[model samples]
Target: MTNQIYPCLWFDGQAQAAAKFYCSIFKNSKITADNQMVVTFELNGKKFMGLNGGPHFKFNEAVSFVVDCDTQEEIDNYWSKLTADGGSEGTCGWLKDKFGVSWQIVPTVLPKLLSNPDKAQNVMQAYMKMKKFDIRELENA
Candidate 1:
């Protein structure tokens, strides 16, 4: 037997809708299966399960999905889309989608920029005040 690990999200009677919404966002994603209670989907190849478990549980910032974007345009695209409708932005590339799911839209170059001892502070300072990450700003920092 093989062990497979994947995240299961809890939704308030919006499992299928959330799954479909996610599928529409990612380039290669689809809903594998959906029923009244559960929806299984793949986002860019990673499997996820969304459960229509009612309002008993809610998503919080404690757990979040991180999207690594290679360019500012990518970051901006994701930020704008994910923060649309009822979604809201948070500090440092964090945002809550319409379903209240937290996501972090980060630049792929962030790690390398933050790892540089000389500019680490500047990089940190620059990103700390940002809602969406800017690759150019990180590089300049």
Candidate 2:
């Protein structure tokens, strides 16, 4: 048997709506199924299932979807859109969308920059000060 792992998002009642919103944001994404119990979707080729499980559970920062972008434009684009409407921004590129799902919009180079021993502290300092990530600033740090 082939084993596969996919994230299942728990939603109070907006599973389909949240899935649709995610699909609209990422490339190569789509809604594969929708029904009273669940909504299945894909984002950037990753499969996700959203369950309309009721008010028993809610989303928090413990788990978040991270979006890694190659350019500042991509980062900005995603950050702006995700934080738009009723979404609120958090420090270090974290945010919660209108549906209360957490996300991190980060540049692809962030990890590499932070991995450098000489620059790690500076990079971290710069990163901790911003709501959205800026690749150039991190690089400069």
Best by lDDT: 1
User: Taking the tens digit of each residue's C-alpha lDDT, what string does model 1 give over 43-95?
Assistant: 99999999999899999999999999988888988888888889999999999
- The TM-score that candidate 1 achieves is 0.97
Candidate 2: residue 59 Cα off by (Å): 0.4
Q: Give per-residue lDDT, candidate 1, residue 127.
A: 94
lDDT score at residue 38, model 2, on the 0-100 scale = 97
- lDDT of all the models against the reference? 0.91, 0.90
Residue 133's lDDT within candidate 2 is 86
Tens digit per residue, CA lDDT, model 2, 46-133: 8999998999988899999898889999988898888878999999989999988899988989879989999999999999899888
Residue 133, candidate 2: Cα error in Å is 0.9
